[model samples]
Target chain A: MSIQDEFSFINQIKPTTVHHEKTLITGIGDDAAVYIPSPNQSQIICTDTLVEEIHFTSQTMSPFQIGYKALAVNISDIAAMGGNPLYYLVSIAIPSSWSEQDLIEIYAGMSELANSHRVDLIGGDTVSSKDSLMITVTVIGETEEGRQLLRSHAKSGDVVFVTGTIGDSSAGLELLLSKGRHGTFNSNEDFLIKRHQYPNPQVKIGRFLSKLKRVSLNDISDGLASESNELAEASQVTITLNANLIPLSKELVSCDSEGAIEKALFGGEDFELVGTMSMDEWESIQQDGRLQNLIKIGTVSSGKPEVLLQLENELITLEKKGYNHFKK
Target chain B: MSIQDEFSFINQIKPTTVHHEKTLITGIGDDAAVYIPSPNQSQIICTDTLVEEIHFTSQTMSPFQIGYKALAVNISDIAAMGGNPLYYLVSIAIPSSWSEQDLIEIYAGMSELANSHRVDLIGGDTVSSKDSLMITVTVIGETEEGRQLLRSHAKSGDVVFVTGTIGDSSAGLELLLSKGRHGTFNSNEDFLIKRHQYPNPQVKIGRFLSKLKRVSLNDISDGLASESNELAEASQVTITLNANLIPLSKELVSCDSEGAIEKALFGGEDFELVGTMSMDEWESIQQDGRLQNLIKIGTVSSGKPEVLLQLENELITLEKKGYNHFKK
Candidate 1:
């Protein structure tokens, strides 16, 4: 885009109301954004990039969904850290082939989610790219002092739980890839597709869990197997997951029990909360009405770092086979 | 790069020490990095993207220079805002052709600069790209409350000043583009090429200027002509720059004066500070021995928002003709 076009695009997406006006001294239209941090709060920051073709195809995702998911993934990181996302910066490299309208739609998608969580768009860059479109989002968040959750805090005998269904997103992606974009889908297929296109980061659940004593948390970005392995390795413990207890969406299970289980084990991009907590803490969370969907999926044990799946009567080691960008 | 490769790269670049241990709660190897903000300080944040071929070609820059320039530009933004850069996040999209050693060297370039400023590498993402490499850096900084310098704070009777020399970078770029990368060069040519490859962001000068009574600041990333117009328009004033007074490096002036003037006016990526301050404040800063290189280039006047260049005997309106990514 021309400099004028870039400026116009920025003006279009410039936020009208900053959620934390007291803290946000400057948002857009400046060399850098300025904000006053809330005293005694720990700040959370993370960045994620979405490259066209590699992350999503136009056939499978609209520009709106692409933008929404880009920000959603960053927010999910903050959720995994037990923080509330407060501000975000987006740097988008656009190809000449894309229209301004498409860019605006993408920003709208991000704004919808940002407005919901009161996150403000602070500062970003808009530049032209030679070919594919790329969006990199950096989110800044905050939580109470010393309340940040981590992957290394899982203790032996902690009950492992996952919030909401797993494998739905990967199943959705599979359906989209197998059946062309224009194909009509049943209600189940539509739900699965939506799951893939629009992920809801578990911010509230993460915050609630962070308030509990002695909890370790991780977001299900990569598959359960990979994430479980990470948590186990970080905590230096062995995690045993019950195959039957792994949550699967009804739509995912309808395909085939074995296939759904496989997807749950190795498919990724679920944006769900998975963590280990003391049994008493888990029991206390179970009594909360909002956490009804929380599922007990495994147990942590003091042993050599590894992830194991309890399948039928056999104990099998789970491999880290989630999406690897350079694995080919 | 496989998942194993990505993990190994992360391990390689993982920071050994955090500069601000009290505020930095978490650094790398986490879902999101956590830090505590300095009490009562305003946080400054900005992001910039450097795209392959568009921003720099492999022919024009080494991978090390590419990485160094990527973070430097973002640091320049924070400097422009009168803040001390403390932490940064980098997201790099690599092509299959790049070796692991090249990536490591790129990180080393960034680490060299980061260590000088005591800035910490907080968090980032490394992913594979289909073709060209793309690097985006987001910097977080801070300044004392309400001390941010802005583009809109200049007033009538303010004297416009530029820190250090201008046009050297663009002149360097011209030499590189015209003579090609491997050609032998004299001392002047070497100096110009180094200026193009490595820019020093004026962080100290910016902080010094920010402490003044009132100053309007901008970094010359997009040429003085464009930046002058920005300050003029933002402050609702007219800026008149004296062509005779525009600072130029000896190497740049070794070329024709007209050509040097052209480069000084419209060429960019200097990362030098440009601002307007009250004549008294300017005079006070001039007395500082370290600020001897500061040049009085223009004056701000109350008039229609525009930029004008005062030539030998006439005043000509300067158009916004800086580098535009999509102008072609």
Candidate 2:
């Protein structure tokens, strides 16, 4: 469709999450979304940016996939905080050599994920570049009264828990890079490939945990150890992890123990929920089966973060863990 | 101040404005800006991107200025539609070349303007770029009920008007490129320099125009001729410009008439609002002393967009008379 048609079509994905803030009159489809004010809820805001070579390899993923992932990652952040995904603004820069089909695919991919997440694409910026492609997605989400979860909320003695499986994404990335072709892997491993390339966000789980049921929470995009470190840093509490308990993929079992453990601990883009719950609440959820692999790996502590690897009789500091975005 | 201190401290300015629609929940602050939604208002959305070596040269403007302009241009789109300036989301990709100090200054510039406009910065994406630097800003604004203007609203027999002057930015750019470090120009003329370096988005004027006072509206960023043509195409109406009525800079007056007219008609980045207004409303606004230089420049007609010259005495179709980001 034409550019005008695309915009008109986008207009239909207006948000349904009713707003209590009196200031915001129009959210997505205007020159600027209007906001009056609501004394009831204090707004929380954040922003991020991605570049062509830095965030993704245009060699591996399509522009559309890149576009979708850009927003998906941001949405994961809001979900980690137990917030409802409301709307998002996007900004893109493409090189002159790129085709119109490339742009169409990019927006189409973003629109696809955005529609599924029910987050409206409100507005953004597009400009031509002499360099590589760049995409940025900014999301707005809301938390109900007294339900917002933060990294700082993990009190000492709170049980550390994670939802769903981890290391699948990192493993998938290794497979994609090493194998090059998807067909070379076991077709059952197709699921792993998808996890790394197209991570499905757990918004519903986030919402569930936001009910003050969890003392703290974080999305596992930057691997478990990295996020755990973040929780510890923000909460100013020490965390000790039972490295033996951290979940790994069946594929990881075939791999070397050291490799499997490393991936589970530090390979990024897991998109799983790493959270903290009071000892009682953690027990309740484990019995509920609503969360498949929800396991208690350790506890909040007054001392520094430590990884107790029973097999090796080792205790490693949080800094010894793998790579993080801000880390050198 | 240290980079970290500047980054945190820049978030303090929060100016407030009275005019707004009903859909904005929270502007600025938090993880992302919130928008409410008013079904009566048709949301208009647009996005643009800027990259290093493509949009600006660091030699001409500081990184802070670049950051501020990146946001200001996006907001200008909202202004063009006559909408209220609300909060915006930002996405930035930086290369290793930049120091932490550089990032702080860049953000400081953006925060400075956002505070003045009462626009909150909600959320964005940041990633390492392997190549060039990029900054993208997405602004959301609102228009009142029954007042949202569109580029497709012009009708035959309507008078065309433009807010503020045009062509100053192109002139400023010319001076900047020359590296005339010691010379000074008019304070009013300096407006051109700032206009080129930091074009102002007319938020209040846009809010006023989107209130149905005008039949059609667009911002003059890609030159007047291009915008005129866009309105004509969108509205299915013809636009005719009176050669004498176009705004000219003092720098332009010193140049040959042909060169002056070239910049006046086709030079981009003026960031002025161009619109079609009914005869009566046009007269009233003209009589108001506050909007005096807001001049009548043309008229809508039944044919295609045509440029008229007193000497030629005939209509000439203006073809390829403006800047195209792709072509540039």
Candidate 2 chain A vs. true chain A: TM-score? 0.84
- The superposed Cα distance between candidate 2 and the true structure at residue B130, in angstroms, equals 2.5
Please write out the lDDT profile of model 2 over residues B85-117, one tens digit for every residue.
Answer: 666666666677877777767777877778778
Tens digit of lDDT per residue, candidate 1, span A252-273?
8775566898888788899998
TM-score on alpha carbons, each prediction: 0.97, 0.81
Candidate 2 lDDT over A146-211, as tens digits, reads 566777678877988887767877777777677653347775466676777787777888888876
Q: What TM-score, to 2 decimals, does candidate 1 have?
A: 0.97
- Candidate 2 chain A least-lDDT 10 residues: A1-10
True contacts kept of each: 0.73, 0.46
- Tell how far residue A311 is off in model 2, in angstroms: 7.5
Give Cα-based local distance difference scores for all models: 0.88, 0.67
